[model samples]
Target chain A: METQLFVQIALNGWNQQVARAEKFFNGLSDEAFQRTVGAGKNRIIYLYGHLTAYHDMLKETLGLGTATHSFLVNDFLKNADDVKANMPSVAELRQYWAEVHNELNVLFAALPAEDWFKRHNAMTDEDFKKDPTRNRLSVLLSRTNHIAYHFGQLVLA
Target chain B: METQLFVQIALNGWNQQVARAEKFFNGLSDEAFQRTVGAGKNRIIYLYGHLTAYHDMLKETLGLGTATHSFLVNDFLKNADDVKANMPSVAELRQYWAEVHNELNVLFAALPAEDWFKRHNAMTDEDFKKDPTRNRLSVLLSRTNHIAYHFGQLVLA
Candidate 1:
């Protein structure tokens, strides 16, 4: 397949997962978001926030822009869900989720086909040179799966 | 990136998920497999068998080989888990999981890079002509996410 087509396929997969997540979280009730995946697992709210924070970081990770929601890093990314930790309300998280993905969609579309194969900010130049498979497209693919993984947990709520 | 590199990345993602599922399931106690993801959702055994059955179908879906575990289709694929339905023992499902993925790993590695871009058995020639993105590699990518989705549920067990 052509390189452009390959890039499109990867992007399409990412977009599909993004859409699924958006729809699922949008429909969830505020109370439902408080429920854990199991008796003692991450709550739906935390997963939603964690996903949003991760997507926000993708801006810098992909070298397209800066992370707009860095404030969510400590609560949603670095630490697991804590009842005591200050968290955004479900309404605020919903807004942040939409904002992060909306901005990402634009940045992702503007990325040239060849640029998807280039190294992202997370990889060292020498490391990327030695292992070119760890490119922007691969990161997108991994993140796509990441969303699906968490969405699985969300479904149990 | 080169086409070979693209194929490698997709396959690597698939393999990584497979390894994770293997490790997670193997370490789980037989009793744990009986637990559901939530209070009334799919039990871990059902998800294990469901994933195994899906991978078995991939053999034919990729046009590489025939399914070796067609017996699992009706219970694990065509229908949801039923308390009254006859099911495989946890040990049996574990064995099937290993067999299906082990065989697939061999078939997948033997496939040429260019072949990954070709249409799979599930797609029509006309549809594939209009949309080449629905190729074998795309199926693998989707299935990779599928496993990750289920793995998320499995983790809650």
Candidate 2:
């Protein structure tokens, strides 16, 4: 019930989901990663890139630091997959995935417990004050669910 | 953050996901609901039933009440879908989904804020003491992610 404990629960859930996704993608072959979940649906590669791009932004969103993989934003986040678009190699994206999450892990670990209750950069102070639920921990919780949701789709790939 | 606020965030996340999924499924035609996420993967109807069955069990898991749709457990929860299996009609499962969640909304609304910190029926007292994060709110948080995960898959249908 303490703030530290509450923050720990949110962080643990985020870590658990990130681990699950990492393991799932790590075990996938490059060919399998290229396969779409279904005909004409987003490819596994795109989802992997999408997740990496989103988490890369989480650094800024959480007020931890700037995004390390900002270049991926236009390709993966701004647009749906276009088979002809220039994109990173699966190998490159794999490395980005590791680096981004590893960096996030360290940043997240060093975050003071009380900071989790503070508003992230994405929210206006006025909006966050009106609904305190839109704090940093809430972003982590929502993004944790976001990862799980995508992981669910990835499993069907 | 206070315990009441933390609990509200978790419950609100759960409600938001449930509403998203409910809207998605409600808008789907029976033909679309019957379509599989991928070849030989879960059908949307199966996921709907599975979610209903899982939420039905949440009543007991949260120690709010016994499962009202106990009969759905074996078909929807314990076993993978079989084309030949005697499953509920799509219409029938749709009705169950609404009923189960509606009942859960009432039960969840009545739960005291402090009670969210208590261990549910699923965990032993010693286990809960060892890791208080495994409380009723934790279960809700995990299940909220579970729904989001499946909803991610369902959208591909």
Candidate 3:
């Protein structure tokens, strides 16, 4: 595969994952959003916020855009997937999600193909050289899988 | 993007999803496999079987291979997602999962790039002509997302 085409497919696949989420969530009732699934006992509202929080963090992490949910990192990232009382409501989280999704898509659309191969997140030159797979495009691709994981769970919810 | 490279990357991505599922399912304990999520409601075994059955059908639908579980098609396919009393044991389902997964991977690996562009499953030539998006490669790509969706749910299990 030419590097350009390879990157484009990855980018389109990533966007498709996002679109799947929007399609899955579109027109879902508010009661449905608050529904809980699994023995873990988390509500869909919490998962939606958690998903949006990750995207918000990813925007900053990949330098595609700025972080929109600096407040959510502690509650959502590395935290157990349990329901938290303080999570933003489904409506607010959806707005945050749409914002991050729009900006990230724009960033991806505007990105030069070469930029996909650039260093990402907090990695220094030496860090990136040692693990070239940690590049910006890799971040996009991995986050795509991450989003898919949550969407699967949502369907069950 | 050259069509060949685009198809190649798509193929590799499809296999990567399989590898991820194998890695996730490899060492799961029998108890864990049967463990119920959604508050003792849905069992992992049912979900596993459902996932495998989908692949078995996809192999035939994409013309990659024959169906390994015609018997399972009636129960697991369009039926409800709930756990069933008559469902196969975890080991038996695992065997089916492995068989379908292996054969499907082999089929995908050997698929000609041009075939990926051909019409798929129930789509007639006339339908494919109207909406080329319903081609074989599109099926593989969509199923890749399907696998990811289930994997997300499995991790919770």
Candidate 4:
């Protein structure tokens, strides 16, 4: 597959990584996820929500995409583990995980090949015209990096 | 750029993530890295070498490239923290990190655009002919996920 077809190949790889990361999460002990991990004070659950929130936010930024976990944005984004008392249940977070991926998968599969090059959500025609790099492909590339970064964290957890 | 030239765009993003990960590594305190991270028995140093060695091995697997850290493959690959006594010093592993990345950057830049779709190192010409999916693009995609997965692990350190 060349460029356009490369989209599906890339998307498949991303979905696999998400599955791989969730597997790591599933293997973790409850206490382990609740405690601070590595150098950061954030617990494993915080990172989980952090990742979910990122995908949810991406839904808005990428344009033409729907978010599955808008409710997570406030408590999880940049909150880290500080608000432990208010954090969502692990069951709810796990549900958000599946919902986010499912939503993205359906939404993405429906987008025609040309749409991958179009500008996402909030950017205006003039803004996109000025900065052509902020297209759908660029967002896809960034999200892959984002998920991989978190996947690495999950490995440690 | 479309699919073929999309190589460079993807490469640029991978490089930026590597830079971002290295920045995180550079910021860690000595004690923090030595401590057990999260629920895993492995330490930060092992994860560091794990990532570097993966790229090093990928260098050979994807073909037309040489591994920079051959010494590390036996020790770091699949060994995990079990062989900590035999593991390379943190300083030495850090050196391998830079060496492996430098080696890959030079090697990849030299490849022609079409080389990306060519067969990888070990796959038989006949086999690859049957399964064209195992081309240079797939290798590139896998390595990107690998690095991102490991990069996430480093964030915890």
lDDT (tens digit, per residue) of candidate 3 on B1-157: 2455456546665677778887777778777876754555456777777788888899878876789787776667767555445777778877888888778778877887667777887788899777666677667767777777777777777
Q: Each candidate's TM vs. the true structure?
A: 0.96, 0.96, 0.74, 0.82
Query: Which candidate do you rate higher for TM-score, 2 or 3?
Result: 2
Deviation of model 3 at B81, angstroms:
5.2
Every candidate's lDDT: 0.91, 0.90, 0.73, 0.73
Model 1 error, position A123 (Å): 1.9
lDDT of 3 by residue, A10-63 (tens): 776777888888887776887787676555456777667777788888877887
> What's the lDDT for residue B119 in model 2?
91
Query: Candidates 2 and 3: which is better by DockQ?
Result: 2
Q: lDDT for model 1, on a 0 to 1 scale?
A: 0.91
Best by DockQ: 1
lDDT of 1 at B7: 97
Q: Measured against the native two-chain assembly using Cα atoms, what DockQ does each of the candidate structures obtain, in the order listed?
A: 0.84, 0.80, 0.33, 0.48
lDDT of 4 at A22: 83
| Residue B2, model 2: Cα distance from true site in angstroms | 1.0
Best lDDT goes to which candidate?
A: 1
* Candidate 1, position B55, lDDT: 94
Q: Candidate 4: DockQ?
A: 0.48
Whichever of 1 and 4 has more lDDT, that candidate is 1
What lDDT does candidate 4 reach at residue A46? 86
**iRMSD per model?**
0.8, 0.9, 4.4, 2.8
lDDT tens string, model 4, B1-157?
4654466656776787678768877777655668554555667777777778888888888886777677887767866576446778777877888988888888888987767778888699999888776777777777776767676665544
